[model samples]
Target chain A: MSAVAKTLDVKGLNCPLPIVKTAQAIKELAAGDLLEILATDPGAVPDFNAWTKSTGNELVEQSEEAGVYRFVVKKKG
Target chain B: MDDSQGTLSLVLFSGTDDKLSSASILTAGAAALGRKVNLFLQYWALENFQKDRIAKDHGVSKDAEPEGASLMRLMREQGSTQHWADTFRQAKEIGDVHLYACALSMEMFGITKDDLDPLIDGVWGVASFMLEADGPVVFI
Candidate 1:
């Protein structure tokens, strides 16, 4: 597993906010850095997928446990 | 990264909290995906942008009467929902989002640019808004 440069906890935020904050947080990371996001919104699953694809970032890992959705995205090099 | 997803133009005609919140969410989502978002505030929507009224309660739309209105109020009281203005601010911070007041509406309300909250970029005529719309405009 690649090292995560940052972990964004957006557990309580609703739709758009989780993705919005992720977009803002990922901007501060260097290329190739990994951003692990923890979100409670079920929408995050599909939101992250579309976000990564549209923004050209790599969704290196994704999983859900006990209703919490986790995603590890690597900034495009 | 493809920041060229094109512009999403929105016409905000309703001033209700629920409507504004919905529009704000759409703006933020579009912005997060690297799309430019242009919001044209008109009629009641433009009136709500006044600096003194922006933070006040604008209430829910008529469609959300009775139980639905109370649910929204409860969420807001619980601090579970973000204010629409703040959402728009964050959207602008992270992407190409611009808010403009309709010039005709401004004249109707007798409000100058300074009367509005700083969140609004400027006052624009219908022609100017259409020129930048670039695609189908969504009215809220």
Candidate 2:
């Protein structure tokens, strides 16, 4: 697995904030770097998938545990 | 990411907090996906963007009723909900989001560019707004 370049904690935020914050965080990363995001919003599951897809990034991994959703997304090269 | 998704234009006529919040979320989401967002504020919506009043309470839409109002209040107290203006500011910071005040509404409300909050890019006429609105506009 590729190393995570940054970890973004977006817990307690709802709706578009997680996606918005993720987009902002990803912008600071070099192309091909991985961003690990931890979010409490249930909507993050689908939001992350769509966000990565539309932005041309890759969803490297995604999982949920005890209501928290985690996503590792690789920036498009 | 490329701005290949095109522009999403919003015509905001309502100044209610709930409606504005919803609009801000839509703007932020579109912005996150590399879309250019253009917001044209008119009528009551323009009034809420005044420099001195932007942070003040604009209340909920009448349809929200007392119950919906309390629910929103509860969410706000929990810090789960952010002010719509702040969200718009963040959207602008992170992406291509432009906010414009309707010139006709500005004339009706006796508001000038100086009276508006700094978040507004500028005052625009209806024709100017339509020119940038390449896609179907969402009215709120």
Tens digits of per-residue lDDT for model 2, B22-71:
99999999888889999999999999999899988888999998787778
Q: Which residue segments of model 2 deviate by more than 4 Å?
A: none
Write down the worst ten-residue block by lDDT for model 1 chain B.
B1-10
Give DockQ for candidates 1 onward, in order.
0.82, 0.84
**Scored by Cα lDDT, where does model 2 land?**
0.92
Specify the CAPRI tier of model 2: high
**How accurate locally is residue B96 in candidate 1, as Cα lDDT from 0 to 100?**
91
Clashing pairs in 1: none
Error (Å) of candidate 2 at residue B16 is 0.5
Which fraction of the native contacts appears in each prediction? 0.83, 0.83
Expressed as tens digits, the lDDT of each residue in B65-97 for candidate 1 is 867777888887776578999999999998899
